[model samples]
Target: MKRIGLTGGIGSGKSTVASLLVAEGAVLVDTDAIARSIAQTGGIAMPAIEAAFGSSVIAPDGSLDRVAMRQLVFTDAGAKTRLEAILHPLIGTETQRQAAAAGDHAVVVFDVPLLVESGRWRTLVDRVLVVDAREETQLQRVMSRSGWAPEAVRAVIAQQAPRKARRAAADAVIYNESLTLAELGTEVRGLWKLWAAATTR
Candidate 1:
């Protein structure tokens, strides 16, 4: 499998690009989905999460209390580390399982949001595809999508690697700024052809 690590800052339309790739036959290993699965009720990581963060971090319905945990990790570095410790391994395991189960494919895109910040995923993937947009664009997109305040969007951005850093880490980049869906589809098709050809050889 030719592993492509896909990442972008919040609201950069990474998911849009990922969907386009999937439509073009790329196997997707979505880390965010894996994380959500592991945080669901009776998930593999739930026991560890509860043990680390206490039952208060679990909702009354038995799932992770995402809001509470998000708040904790936002304010506390130690809490962030603890949360990563619980979720990363589970996500990694599931990622591997999904990747292994995929057929002979030219591209298997690992849609990981923090690929740049993790400082480890770059070496694992055959190529890194950074879906990019301007900071102001990102902030506005996130606010509109999530109904978050400007400061909330900024806070999330602050925790991420800078745009320059993401660009530097990228082997490929899709400038997702102001492109219509049809335009984006054309761009993704071009990339899929390029990557699929390169990987098959």
Candidate 2:
């Protein structure tokens, strides 16, 4: 199987590219989805999360209070490390399990939002595809799509690896700025042909 790592900063339309790849027959193992699954009520990681952050970060429904946790992580430097410590291993294990289960898929894409920050995914995949956009574009897109304040969007961007770093890590990059959906789809299709050909060879 060909393992491809797909990543991009917030508001770069990484998820859209991922979906397009899926439409083109790539089996997607989305780490973000895995993280959510493992953080739900009664999930495998909740006990550890509650133990680390206390009940304040857990909602009444027993699921994680994402907003509270996000605030904490942003305010407390150590909190982000602690949270990653608890979740990364679980995410990695689950990612592997899912990838193993994907039988005969020509391309298996691992959609990891923090691929550059993770420090390990670089060596795990055959290639890294970055969906790139300028910081201003990211700020505008995120604020508009999520109704977040501009500063809030910037804060999230600050926490991620810089655009240059992501670009440097990429084996391929899809510049997602200023493209219409149809144009973006065409771009993904073009990459699909090249990547599919590569895997076969």
Candidate 3:
């Protein structure tokens, strides 16, 4: 299988491009979804999370209290490191398992929002496909879609890798800032054709 590392900044329309790839029959391994699954109630990572952060970060129903954890991590620099240590390995293992299970000729796209920051994904995939957009475009899209304040959207954007860095890491980039859905799909299909053709060679 050929593996593609798909990534983008928040609100860059990475998910939309991912769906387009799926429509082209790409097998997707969404790391964010896996992370959420592992942090949910009765999840594999819950016990370790409880051990690391204690019961305060756990909801009454036993799931990770995302709001509480987010607040804690924001206040404590070490808290984010601790959380990543717990989560990254599990996410990586599951991600690899899914990719390995793909058909021999399949094009497996790993949709990782943090692929640039992770420091390891670049080495794992055959190519990196970054979904790109201007920072102001990202801020507006996030605010409109999520109903978040501008500052709140900016704060989230601040935590992600910079546009230049993500573009530098990309084997290909889809500039998504001003494109309509149809245009975006067309772009993704063109790239998917290239990747799909490469898999056969």
Candidate 4:
């Protein structure tokens, strides 16, 4: 099996691209979804989080209050790192297990929002495929889609790896600006063929 890392900045339509890849028969492992599951109330990462950040991070329903945690982490770099320390290992283990179970002939797509930021997982994949868009587009998309203030969106973007750095690190880039879903799908299909050929070699 070939492990392909798919990444992009927030609101760059990475999920949309991942969906297209799924339609192309790739086995998708969404790290964000896995992290969310592990952070839920009484989830694998909850004990460590509660210990580190206290019970305030937990919701009334016994789930991790994602909004509260997000607010806390965004303000405190150490807290963010602590959270990552707890969750990254679990996410990575599950991702590897799933990829291994996919067997040969499967294209395992690891949809990671922070692939560039994490840096350590580059060796886990055969190639990095980044979905790219202009920063202005990203800000607009984030504001409209998330209903967040422009400043909030900008702050989130500020914390992520810059577009130039991400592009430089990418083995492939999918320009997402001014592209329709059909166009995006076509591009992904083309990349699928390329990835298949490369991995087979």
Best by TM-score: 2
lDDT of 3 by residue, 54-105 (tens): 9999999999998899778767889999999999999989988988889787
In TM-score terms, candidate 4 sits at: 0.95
Model 3 clashes, total count: 0
Q: Once model 2 is optimally superposed onto the true structure by TM-score, how far is the C-alpha of residue 36 displaced, in angstroms?
A: 0.9
Model 1: colliding residue pairs: none
Query: For residues 1-201, could you state the per-residue lDDT of candidate 1 as single tens digits?
Result: 789999999999999999999999998999999999988998888899999999889999789999899889899999999899888988998998999889765478999999999999988999999999999999999998889899889989999999999999998889999999999999999988998899758
Once fitted onto the true fold, the runs of candidate 3 whose alpha carbons sit more than 4 angstroms away are none
Top model by lDDT, which number?
2
Per-model lDDT: 0.92, 0.94, 0.92, 0.89
Q: What is the lDDT of candidate 3?
A: 0.92
Error of 1 at 36 (Å): 0.4
Worst 10 residues of 4 by lDDT: 40-49
| Local distance difference test, candidate 1 | 0.92
lDDT of 2 by residue, 1-201 (tens): 899999999999999999999999999999999999999999999999999999999999899999899999989999999999999999989999999999866589999999999899999999999999999999998988999998889889999999999999999999999999999999999999998898767
- Ten consecutive residues with minimal summed lDDT in candidate 1? 99-108
User: Candidate 2 or 4, higher lDDT?
Assistant: 2
